[model samples]
Structure formats: structure tokens, C-alpha cells
Target: METFKKGTQRLTDNEVDQLMKRQPHLLKQSYDQIPNLTPNSQEVISRQATINVGTIGHVAHGKSTLVRSVSTINTVRFRQERVRNITIRLGYANAKIFKCPKCPEPQCYQSFSSEKESNAQCELCKEVMTLVRHISFVDCPGHDILMSTMLTGAAVMDCALLIVAANMPCPQPQTQEHLVALVITKLKYVIVIQNKVDIIFRDQQAALRNYEEITRFIKGTIAEDSPIIPVSAQLKYNIDCVLQQICNFFPIPDRQLQVPPKMIIIRSFDVNKPGEKPENLHGGVVGGSILQGILSVGDEVEIRPGRQSKNGNQTTWHPITTRVVSLYAEQNELVYAVPGGLIGVGLLIDPSLTRNDNLVGCVLGFPKQLPELYRELEINYYLMVSVVGAQQQDGKTQKIAKIQQDEMLKFNVLSNETPGRVIEVREDKIMRVALNNPVCTGLQEKVAFSRRLSNKFRLIGWGIITDGKTITL
Candidate 1:
């Protein structure tokens, strides 16, 4: 038995270790009786079932503000985004919905509360209850020139929140384009967020008119059935209702971890600090979502279309092999990564090779498990009835011209965008395209096609990759 002096005495480290070893049952008992003090400790542990929801709308339409409202971590990474007040690249944030113990109603709790209070009591009831769910928000840029970035963000989303500002007229240019993209991406789950209600809080008639216009515009679109929730993300008004709708609509998709691990690299960077010792420096980190299977730490991985190399008169892409040193989901360190949400993978590779997002658009997977690299792709595409987001005369949809042979086009697959030329147009609507840069993609993968109309690449349509090959031309 260990005895202490009447006043107080501190045990030496060796003595403490000896006591713990001799009375291991004491330690076991202490461990077994440990209480879960986390406020939502009783909540269903479904962290692995993370749902990805994307924000798409016109520029200055509160896409970033909406994400900032709900997310615990700042999704905006670049200083330029803060300065310019527009998302230049894809931004991600993790958020949770918690239920109030005192309130039986669904929307009686906070929706956009800070994550620092994750384990704190409910603000309204002051009682702790299990959190309802967790979701990842993908903030897509609304700028016209960044349409390709928006399309890529839409690809990985299970659901979308199409934001429309109430102060502005309904169906802003990007709003229409984003809705079209939802249809092209085959996204069935959607919620239309009519944000900035506070801007028109005093103007009831104007707010009603804007709402009606927005409803009319979305009538024939794919989002026709989506619920329109009026919110004030800036003022944190009606955010709870938005969260309730999301919970009801966006359920987790079935993921198969039995298949080979594969991930699309959306953003990559060298994370080493300046003046850090070379021996202590960490490797570069690749951030994106896993499409399928599981990637565990220390797993050997290969990145395809890895680095550009000049082979005589032609350019070639060689696969790069590296080991995953660490894995992270949101801000939490993860031992293994699974499908359904975004992840960050730390790799044991040369930092210089991954700096400045050089590895962006590359595909990561086990050796020989990635799809074929293609310089030429055959796609069966369909043109939209009207050119989306384009200025139309008389407020009517305008007919777009069919793709012509030998015409230059832009192809977007996953996050990779490449310039290509139409080589062959088939009667069955299949068009063969020769890309200027090679891409790592699989058959049946959805690809968005754009045309240089009026000197800008406007999204025309999307198609599945049917065939790919190395073209000599």
C-alpha cells in the first residue's frame, strides 16, 4: 500500500510506475469507470457516414457566407478569396446538427453554431443531447470564369444547396448555370436556399415578388421539386429550418470499401514551414475525396498522369509511387480513409514535387488499380435546348448550335480540365475528341464538355467516357 504524508507528497515517476504495474487492476478499474463527459456522447456515432453538400450560385450570392455560417472550420483557404470576396478555388467545411433535449421539435436547436461548442449544452434548453448528424460543405466558386471549378465541385456532392439572394432578381446567370450543372451531374437531392432575407426585411412586397420569381424560374428545371427555404445566412436567421431540410433530404450514400482504393486529388500543396530543418520537414499533403475503398496510413499509392515528361516529339505521363504517411478527415487525424467525404492525405514524397498544386487533377490509387490515361476520348453527348447562363433576347431560352467537327472544346473530368478538338462526330451523337493534355480517368466517368463561344469556355453539356486511347495525332 502507498501512503502519503499528512500535508501532501508527490510520488517519483519510478514509484508511480511500480505502483501502477503492481496494482494494474486499480488502473483497469479507473479506466473502466471513466465517464464520457462529451455533451453528445450518447449520440449515434456516425462520423464515418459524412454527407457532402455543395453550395452553388451566382457571385456575391452568399455561397461563402452560408458555408461560414454552418462550418466550424474556415473553408476559405486563400487570402485572395478573402480580399476578392469570391471563392477562387474549392472550399470545404465540416458542420454538425444537434438536437435540443428540452425541445421535441426538429428545428428548435441551433444549426450554424461554432464547433468549439460541439460538446457544450444546448443554447436554448441548456441541456445536452445527442448531435443529429454531420455534414461536409463544398463551397464552389460563383465567378463566371471559374465555371470549370464549380463543375468539379459538383461532381463529388451527394446533394446541393443552390443559393439565390432575395435582394436580387431570381435566376441570376450563375444560378441558372448551376442548376443546369445539377441536372447534368444527375444530382437528385437539392435544396434551394433563398438567402439574404435580412436585406429585404422591411420590404415585404419586394421579398414576396423575388420569391415568386425564383419559384417560377425553377419550375421546369431539375430543382423543380426541391424545397425553397428562405434564410438569412448573414444574420443567422432561419438556419435551423435549412438544417432540418438537409437532414431529411441528404442521407448517406452506400459506399463499398471492398473495392480497390481510389481518390481524386482536388488540391495538393507542400505544407513545410519556411526555415524548417530539412530532416524534420514533413511531406506534402493532398486534399480531396475518396471515390471508393479504404486508404490506410502507410499504404503504398500511385498517382497517375503524375508528372509531364517529354518523350521525343510527344508528351507522356508517368505514374509516381509514394507512401501515405498520414490520413485526415476534416481536422481529425484518421487511421484510414473511406469513401463519401473529403480527406487529406500526407505523403512521403519530395515536397518540391507537390508544391503549388502541381499534383492537382491527378488520380491516386493502389499500383495498377487506376484507370487508363487518355489523350483521346470518345463521348456520347447531348446539347442543351438553350445556352445556359447566356444573355437571351426577350427573356426566352435561345437554341445552341450543335458541335462542329475540327472545333476546339474544353473537357472537364473530376477536377481536371483539358483543351481538346473534335475529331469525329457520329450520327449516334457520340463525338471523338483529341485532348491537348492527357488525363487519368475511367470509362463510364461523367465528363463535362464546354465550347469557346464568344471567346469563353461555356459549359455546353456532359457525357460519360465510353472509350479512351493514346492518339498519335
Candidate 2:
């Protein structure tokens, strides 16, 4: 019997009832009755364990977009990245996955949202959910020229997500190289993301064919048994599936927290703004993940092979001693940093020294706890049969030439890259090489080997530092 004026139309009581039944969410409720979607208000509890997952693939594979969709933190920092739509450097983001109470599938999840309304509903089923796990994402640049950067990103990862564009043929140049890099890094858990699935929705046959090609290409590689997840990062379609797979495949590895703390400095910067007061200027910030043990504020740390200095014709490296003034995880200040996730350490050092990533490639630990610095390294070399990313006229990988004595090669360990000259090639594949620059590394640490192909240094294989007793200073 009731009649309500709705602009030009008058709706009856029965009509309004039916409309409200169809959309129950429109019905207003009391403040207490309304579901809370505020992620911050909720006690965001995460298991002490965390895992770092790296994204690797060919250029324009939508790695940054995928990362932004999942994590609360912004991975891309450079203006060049925003303008070019390509990740130029290693980026990082962190996300917490939650399980929905009403949804049976684990894929029905949502990233932590600041908005209370958005957090109130399951992203897929509109159900209430709670956070279950927290994970750190390492976004690696996919450009062919940034292969060394990708290798550095992979070195810090416990697992990897190899993204491939569905619109293009599988195993593109950088794609092949990235896969090989994963193998060399010995990353066991992998999930292949077939991105841009939205573009192929119009053509059923094309989508099916692309899937088959991708499946076949991965069969013979190290990721043969890994799952292929079809997703549309732009549309956010099947993103939940990606998260679900991450929860299933990427398990936290055992950590030896009782040992002396060791961390590889992947990124270092002077976080001071220009024209700031001298007293307000903060110290240098070093960002990276702890490999093992725990580091706390006020801990005295030594950076080995710190800054390069020239004494006559020889370059010498000396360790730098500094105190940890502050600790940060995902931009939030922390009292300490533990193994398993990425952290930023604020050092009480001169800001000018850490500007422009000068502290990158330095290893940090307690004083005298680090391994010896070496300029000469003996490596147990193993060369790949073919060079990935190099294509012949027939679309096959070109055969790699054997490494010769006295030939120069690029050696990558952690975040450091140095030119090495092969001094002696033994019959057993062990090579004695002299580094053009000094590196602070321990024995048995993995080193990626690269050779000059055409004009670029293409990744060839991997080796281990068997002997590095020769110190530079």
C-alpha cells in the first residue's frame, strides 16, 4: 500500500521489498550490525615465519601490475618505471593472505585494504574473512639488459613466480634466460603465471593453443612440475587463484636464527631530502633480507669490502664499522629484524657515502664474523650447452662456445658484478680466475657466470667459489 517517489517513478511497497531482497546490502544496518572491514582495527596477526617470492619473466610480462594487485606496499619507486611502464630496478612489496569463512576455496581471498567497506567483503564471494599468512614479494626487472639485476633478485628469493605473457609465444628470449637463472639459483618452488588472459578471451582456440605451447615449453625445464596459473593482472581476474597457489607451493624454509646474523645489502640509499636542516638529516638506509640469524637495533655491524680505494696500481677494500640506529620492515619501524623477510637497516654513517646505491654488494655481520675478501677466486665451473635468449634463424637456441683460458667473463655473486679473467682452466672444469674488483664472499657461495655474446653479457652457467684466500688489502 505504500508509495515512494523515486524521481519520475513511483515504487510500491511490494516493489521496494522485492528490490531490497534482490540487493540486501543496500539495506542500512546499525553500526554494531555492520561488518567491520577495517584491516588496521583488527589485530593483524601473522605467523612469525615469512617467505620471499620473486617474480621473473620477459619484459612487459605485467610483473609490477601483478605485484601491486597483491601487496599493500608499492614496489616500483623510480619515476622512469612509472613513465615507461617497465621495472628498471629490483622492487619489493608485502601482502597478507586471508581465508574467508563462507568460501570453501582458498582462492577466495583479499589483500589488506585501508578502506573498511572494501575489507568487509570477500573479493570474490563477498564473505567475511580473516588474514592467514604474510609474504614478501620481490619484483625483478624483466628487460633483457637487466639480467644481472634479475640474478641479484633471484639470489635472495626462496621461491619464484615466472610470469609469461599469454598474448605472445611462450619462451620468449628473456623468458628462457630467466628460467635458466632460476635453475642456476636453485629455486625449487615455482609457479608460472600466464598473464594477459583477458586479451585472449575473444578467441577460445587461441587461448587453448597458447596454454598448450606454454605447457610444452615448461615440461623440459626445471619448472616442469610447477603449476601454470592463468590470470589478468589488469582486470584482477584470477588473482585469488595466484594467491592460493602461493599459499600452497611457497612454504617457509627452516632458519638458523641462533647463528651469527648475516645480510646481503641489495639496496642502500641516503634518505635525506635536499635543503633539509643538517640536524634533521637522517643516516643511510640499507635494505635487504636477512639470510640467517636476527639483527637488532644498537647491534654493531661490519660491512666487508666496503668502499673501493686505489693505492697506487692496486684497489683495496676495507671493512666499515657502523651501529644500527633503526630497523624497518615494509616501511614500518621495528625494534629488530629477523630472518625470512626483507628489512631496511638505518645506519649511523655519513649519508654521502651511501648515496646512489654505493653500499650495494656489501655483506654485513658482526665484526670479524664475515668471510675473507678476495680478488682471486678458484671456481668449479659448469658451462651450459647452449646460450639461452640467443635465437638462431630457425628459432632455436644457439650452441655456446667452450670457455677458453685467459678469456674474460662476468662473475655475479649476490648483488655484486665483477669482470673476471680466467687464469687457468683445469681438465676437471675447475678454473682459477682473477677478479677485476674485490668481492666479500664466503667459500661455497653460488656465483653466476656470464659471457659476452654479441654486445651483451648473456648468462652462461653457474659456479661455486672453491678457494678465495687471496685478499686485496
lDDT of each: 0.77, 0.78
- What are the clashing pairs of model 1? none
Off by over 4 Å in 1: 1-49, 111-120, 392-399, 470-473
Best by lDDT: 2
TM agreement with the true structure for every prediction: 0.86, 0.86
**Lowest summed lDDT window (length 10), candidate 2:** 30-39
Candidate 2 structure quality by residue, lDDT tens digits, 1-473: 35433312345567556544643453233222212312122222242225788988999988888988887556778899888878988998777777788776756666662223224567677777776656778899988788988988887898988999999998798989998898888888899999998999999888788889889999978899999988999888998888888877777676666567899888888999999999898988888888876676557898978877877996667788888877766645544456766778999998887888888888888888887888889889889999887877898878988889999999998877889998899989899889887788889989998988878889988988899756844
How well is each residue in 1-473 modelled by candidate 1, as lDDT tens digits? 33211111234445445545643432332211222212122221233325679999999999888887777456667899878878999998777677776775654556543233346567777787556766778899998888998988886788999999999998898899988888888888889999999999899999899989988998987788889988998887887788778877777676666677888888788889999997899988988878777676557889988877887997767788888877766655554556766788999888887898888788899887888788999998887777788876688765678888999888888878888999999989999999988888878988888877776778888888899895332
The per-residue C-alpha lDDT of model 2 at residue 306 equals 88
